[model samples]
Target: MRIGLLTEGGYPYAAGEPGLWCERLVRGLGQHQFDLYAVGGSGIPRPLPPNARVARTADLGGSDSGPTARNLLERTAFGDRRAARRAYGRRERRRFVEALHRLAVGVCGEHTAGTGEAETGAELGIAFAEGLYALAELARERGGLPGALRSDDAVRTLESACRAPGARRGAAAAGLPDHLAFVEHLERTLRPLSLDWYAEDALGAADLCHAAAGGTTALPGLLAKRFFGTPLLVTEYGVQLRSHYLSAAGADRSAPLRTLLAALHGRLAAEVYGQAALLTPGNAHTRRWQEKCGADRARIRTVHPGMAADRFAEVGEDEESGDPATLVWVGRVEPAKDLIALLHAFAEIRALQPDARLRIVAVPVRDPGSGAYLAHIKGLAAQLFPDEAAGAHAVGENPVTFEELGGPEAPTLEDTYASGAVVVLSSVVEGFPTSLVEAMFCARATVSTDVGAVVEIIGGTGLVVPPRNPRALADACLALLREPERRHRLGAAARARALELFTVEQNLAAFRGIYLELLSHAPVRHRPGDGVPFAHPAEAHVPGSWAPKAAAGTGAPDA
Candidate 1:
């Protein structure tokens, strides 16, 4: 089957979040034909996988690009729907407006488990909520949606939702800056609605539209079903909705804005689950989130993100040979990764074992904000370990060294893993925990803060610590440091588990079956003798809709 694989910021791009996984999927499933459609993150060069035949690509532009919407006329050749929408009488317009209103104001975010729609038959409510909006897209705009979805209406909803009881903590966003931001964000969030991606040429041709992440990516999938009776498979390794909540929590953005955006995302997720043929969350953690989002338990499948095993093959086998005194922390040096906390923990580890030195080897993903954060961590290291500055070996002998991967000093990933007795993660927020998996591949014992998917990924093979607590993090690292035999045992077990469950082979096999499974029960749309796809039925045409019968036979009915 030909697959139109949709992606945002991960695949086909030289640098994307799910790039490796998508590349692996394409390469592994050589039998399938794939037309990759990419939406690239700003400034990042996207490289297509060798197996994928790229159809189209769009730049999400930048963080500052104003709100976007897909204009229907520009995207579709819906011969009759345009007129049908314009001719919608009063009743049609009212129903459409009501659905749009409820959708915009629904109180939920990515984290809100959907109202238990399955047991309660709440899919109807979700359908009513989702269908109304989709129908509105096809619904006669009679007088053009009665002014709903306008800036003024948006302003009012923003006002009401923000002031409503149980508002988010950021509720104080009542000022001008806040209001404008809301308008800006709302438009961008709704951009997918305006796209013609749902049309047969874009998203409809595929057997299933699989969105790599939620939020913007799911929009086209929604439209695909609306236009072509296509099924959708949404796979979210890092819950987009949860990320929104976390980002909003610390954001200085506005309370009303957060509330409104959260509601919008929540409703969209519900609508997605309400309509999707299947939902695959990367792990049980994401699975639970989908279930709570009102997805049918039956439809929810836990498909672990596929990680290439090659990176870890060498590290996995030689688990016992890495340095006993050096503890390696490899990843981007971001504030969230909490390297500062790791540094302090290392200071304490030094107290326990004077020979122990913490080597922070930065893995450069080359993000926009990486420079400043890396610089901040470097400065923090200087203040904490002043003796390591340039040429000063002070009283305590600066025991921590900051370095970057792919540099002169640090060797390859295998070499980096070999140089450490333990791998460490100190992030306060994480998702699906890629670093932990990498460490596990190298069969390196790890001490990580119990955050995000650390515990989930580590399972039982490594020591876990509570986040932000330097003391606990220190204790965990030392436990591994003093007991070499224990580290070796845990490392060996971790490698075996990772190879068995997290490889590209397993991921492809799971999806290969899922694709067939979804296709098995899905309704076949094409009809023989219909000619080109989606051609209007002969009876439904207004006599000579396609051609003049006389030029062939009648000529515009003598008009």
Candidate 2:
């Protein structure tokens, strides 16, 4: 079978998100051929397994134009020509206008009224889907949507919809600049309409289209399914819509613009969830989000992300290795981790057990603000532990040590986990909690805040505390520190659970079955010149119900 693997800012790039898992999947399923279609990020290719190869790669992250000839080709194909603009007939124009109006109404309505307004949300969702498909059809028929979507007509349509009665107050307040900015962003997000991947020679040739994530990455697969009847398998480790909400929450954008963008993303997410044959969320937390966004419960499956457990095997088996009085926190240093709360909790724990140590081993994040956040955390640590030498750690001298993952003290991930008896997760916000699972794989007892999937993953194997509560967090840590027998019991249970459900082999097995099951039920849409089914001599004699049976009197099969 041939698979078209689609991704945005992930896979086939060394620095890509979820790159390792994707690589593992491809390498594990060597029997199947894979054609990768990637968008955004540095287009540098990674070393792929022999069965996998790059089919198409595009960088849509910026506004830079490529070669003149390519630009001309795009302009011509996308109906940038004045003659082509004139070719948009009265009927086509009306359809385009109606589509935009419906979409804008949906966006604006939902923003003013909440999603709990079921009648409005449902009506708006239907309108949004209809408008989206109509636009897709128009783009397909008219060559491209760039010219139409960017035209003054589109902006006017948006403005009129925003100002219309029953529209959200925030949307109605949008100025001309806000409308223009939104239109530009929408065009870029919908750029898949102008891409050539939907052609018969491209995505149409694949047996199945597997989207590694949602949002723009799934856009191509959506188009392929629309045009070619190809089945789409969407797997989301993190909900893109939720990420957008968080990002927009922190962005310095106008209220109207933010509301408009949120509505657009929400509608798009609904459409994607509605169309997908199967929705595999990395955890139940994402599954619930998808359900709220309109994904069918029947189609949703929870596939826990696979992690390599071999590296932590030795530590897991040791049982009595790490210091009994130490607690460790591992992950990227970010505000969401709530390291400040962890410090306060540790201060409380210090009062109870003066000999107890806390180790905060973090990997530096790529965000520019992370440096400042790290400095803030270090300052908090110093203020809390006034007497200890916190700079360069001298092992037992400092009660709290802040170290990087690859530093001389903590050379590797396993080393960090192995240094402490209890792994602590102090995150106020989390998704799947990969570090918590890693600690589980290391056979360490855990104390994590009740955020995201922490409770779901822990499943009574470890202690859970409420987010933003230092006292609760401190109490949980104290429980694990005071009772060695309890820690051992939880650690053993945690490791057993990790081995049973979260290994690479289990993930590969699940996907292998899903691919075969999807392909078996899908209708065959063979391309021209493909070889006849069962043409080989050996294949002709294979045992199956379809094979002809021999008559009782003769060796020859019945005609």
Model 2 agreement with the true structure over 326-419: per-residue lDDT tens digits: 9999988888999999999999999999999998888866778788888999998888887776555433587888898899989998889998
Q: Best candidate per TM-score, number?
A: 2
Best by lDDT: 2
Worst 10 residues of 1 by lDDT: 68-77
Q: How far is candidate 1 from the true structure (C-alpha RMSD, Å)?
A: 9.3
**What tens-digit string does per-residue lDDT give for candidate 1 at 146-214?**
223333434455556455553444544455455545545655565555444554566666767777777
Worst 10 residues of 2 by lDDT: 534-543
Backbone clashes under 3 angstroms, per model:
21, 0
User: lDDT (0-100) at residue 132 of candidate 1?
Assistant: 44
Error of 1 at 431 (Å): 0.7
Task: Please report how far candidate 2 places residue 360 from its true position, in Å.
Answer: 1.2
